[model samples]
Target chain A: MDIIVSKDLKKKFKLKHGQRVNNNGVISNEIVVLDGFDLKIKKGEFLVLVGPSGSGKSVFLDIVGGLSTPTSGVVYLDDKIVEAPSAKTGYVFQQYALFPWRTALSNIEFGLESRGVPPEERVKTARELLALFGLSDFEDRFPYQLSGGMQQRVAIARALATKPEVLLMDEPFAALDAQTREILQNELIRIWEGTDTTVIFVTHSIDEAVFLADRVAVVTARPGKIKDIIEIDLPRPRDGDIRSRCEFATNRHKVWDALKAEVNKAQQDWKLAPAFAS
Target chain B: MRLLTVLPKSRVAQREKIISLALGGSVILLFLIGWEILFQSKIVNPLFISAPSRVVLAGITIIKDGTLLHHLGISAREFALGYGAAVVVGFPIGIILGWFKLARATFGPFIAAMQATPRIALMPLFIIWFGLGMTSKIIIVLLSAIFPLIVNLQVAMGTIDADLVQVARSYGATRWQIFRTIALPTSVPFLITGLRLAAGRGLLGVIVAEVFGGAEGIGYMIQYAGSTFQTDKVFAGVLVVAVTGITLDVVLDRLGRHFGKWRSEAAVH
Candidate 1:
């Protein structure tokens, strides 16, 4: 059985009056971002969703994680309907939204504290997570004191501190420099290998999708639904050198082939943005 | 070679602080000297503008005679009571006004109208309602202090990062927990700013209410001295108020810094 499943998921957004233009000189900003989407995520599998910027992948991940409700669909987690946020699901955002007032350890302790874990156990768990993220030395430092990569690591560690069954990451390293991004990508694989948790990641980068995913699902342009799901047959411990391997490039090309049309469609939408924006 | 090395940023900062202090002190000293010279030469009448020496002597006499302390104590108590009431009532109201959309919609217009009205003009109404006593003074201070607190906190709460609150909610934080952990911390710097403004306005309120009617407190002392043409005594009262206001701001600035250390560190982030 799938660890997480979405059945005919649909998400509708009422855009501001200025968001779009109708051909008959009326503003029609009502738009469906996801239309009849279906996805089944297996246990302990790493799934990456690649799509255009407005393709509703993040919203879909949010719905699957129970942080948000779908407009017209059902999401099941472990055979139960997902309704609200729970300790069983952890989410890592693109922005690394660590509380500025909190130190790294304190931030990692936040989820545990909310769960009413005892202070002693909370501290121990946080320390262990910090060590796992290689952030033990920076435990006392605030998020601002750390580099972007380190902050993102802390964000991921904080998410994992609760030991959620499913980890949802939305473009976790999209803001990092190239070197940090590469380093963190490797670290994530290592961390994922050690955990039995299912991971669903959303990103705009095809290379990231190919590198990190057990299966890369390509989402179409807005009013989007899944176009294709491509499995990465590359062997693991898929290290840095794997990008140079023929199979890695082939898998990346496969994802790109599925994703390129949607990107162009999104661009076409933007080309007509002058009429919409005016 | 080590001795010839450049000074660290912190050391340079310390030196800059000393220089600023010296500069500020010199300005005050020079004003005092100029005032004394002009007064002794009778360029300004001694009766109209009291010299620095006479003001000091009057201050010293008031201290020795215990009258100044007595008046100072009354003013301090009135300020404390009024400002305390403002804080006790204003903070939660501000948080409510900030956090809840319904509350903001209900109270926003009323607050805006109230804030727009010059609160000093309401002194007669307060005096008539509460009499020329501590109650009137306290009410005046409360009115003055509360607007800034409410306005600043409301805006602060409104503008707090939605992503922060969303992240907390995603982790299963309840409403109250989110407020305490996410909203409150995010609102601290703004709250401190509101408090600082409230303190100044509170001090002003106490003195104004006291001077306008009350027979006790430093404001009354200043009024009584001015009416009797004892300019030096008036200056002493004025001096006390100035000192108290300055001290309140400095203490608050330090306190704000202590609570708001996250602001400096997280500013660029």
Candidate 2:
């Protein structure tokens, strides 16, 4: 049932910092963010990847979404290597990423337009998706005219419009307020149930990972690798009250425990980082 | 007892408009009255500074003789040829330079240098090559006007977010498709800016060309009347030029607004 398999993935970013004197060039630090990273995502499952800040969770997610290329190693979707971004896999970024110039409905129809869907048909499909997301009346409004939460909903609809087999969301609601974030979590769960697509969601929030994912994958600090993947055995069609349930608190605690060590190490490194420079 | 009555909001808005229009009209009327006072008293010498009434008489005489139309037509034609050609050529070149770094590297410095150099100084060279005909006047107009359009459109192209382009590419959109959907719509405000700047600069250029050495134009008429101490005729020519400049600015502002309504609406944020 596995739909995505990434093996021994690695990424390195070279940072050239400080001043340059006499045209001799400045110093650079090559940070290897991910190495020996391995993961398998099952078909039709909501897999949430949680990691400490700067753990390359988003970077790895981009690689899997075909938005970027790894320094080495391969990520496969149904036995095919993901080489370039295509309509097969859709991505939603942290910043909503809705086109400001486009109206709510037209933003959803963007992917359809790229795929050559006729105007009349794409409008119909976009309109239905807007209604499904409870934004039907705001279809004529631009992204700038919408609230942050409403814009994110449009972003999600835009990602789903092409009917991709895989959806990659990288902290899509990270910019939202706390109350809106909670509401969006429920909407995400609702939307997931309504579709049969495989979702690989990345987040830094423990409560979000536990509340939304079927299984949560915790990653180590820099040079990221999966620390643990915990399966949630909670009852589905779970209502908002489920967050107050004993099992919900337990699962959230479990993810927090796994992530705490890496976070502390990252903070300690951040403090000592200046002294350790080459 | 006089008291202000509270009108409905929309009607009050119209009343505000009327008051504004009245104030705008009074400004011009006051200036005209002051000039007439100064002229009738002969404070600055009547032969040098023409009275408003004499200038109006000169304007009417020129109109009836049909000489004013001929001069204005010549200047208008030169401006149209030069500025129209600049827009047709500068827009695409600016887009190409904006999109491709290599093209920008090659042409950017050259274009900047051309812009910085005073194009009016080239009029003597143009006169020698193309003669003091319509051709020379239009060439000067093109040189003066094209720079702002190119520079503005190029900068506008740069302001488009790279993330938006990446998103479009992620959805399998082609280069042409992406340009049509994203770059073109986004560059509209910049295009309007370029047009506005070019209109002002092109007006200066066409007049300068005519003043320096052109057989017939509003600028030529002014220079001819000034040398002969025909102050009324000179004032008439100046009035025509001022009116033409105001008309151009107003027309361009409306055009810019027509293209920019959606962008401005979104830009409220």
Q: Who wins the DockQ comparison?
A: 1
Q: Any runs in candidate 2 off by more than 4 Å, and if so which?
A: A17-28, A271-278, B1-26, B264-269
TM-score of model 2 vs. true structure: 0.91
- What's model 1's TM-score? 0.94
lDDT of 1 by residue, A1-278 (tens): 59988899998776665666442355576667789899999999999999987778888888877777888999899988888996789999999999889999999999998889999999999999999988788888777677899999999999999999999999999999888998999999988988889999998878888889999999998767989999999888778788788998899889999888899988866543333211
Q: Distance from true position, residue B236, model 2, in Å?
A: 2.7
DockQ of candidate model 1: 0.45
- Candidate with top TM-score is 1
User: Candidate 1 chain B TM?
Assistant: 0.93
Candidate 2 pairs with clashing backbones? none
lDDT of 2 by residue, B153-226 (tens): 89888888776876787787888988998899878888888988898999999988898997888889989988
Per-residue C-alpha lDDT of model 1 across residues B1-269, encoded as one tens digit per residue: 23222245698889999999999999999999998898899987789998999999999999999999999999899999889989889999999998899998898899899999988899999888999889999988999999999888888887777878878888888998898888889888888889989999999999988999989999999999999999999998999999999999989888888886655433522
- When only chain A is evaluated, what TM-score does every model earn? 0.94, 0.92
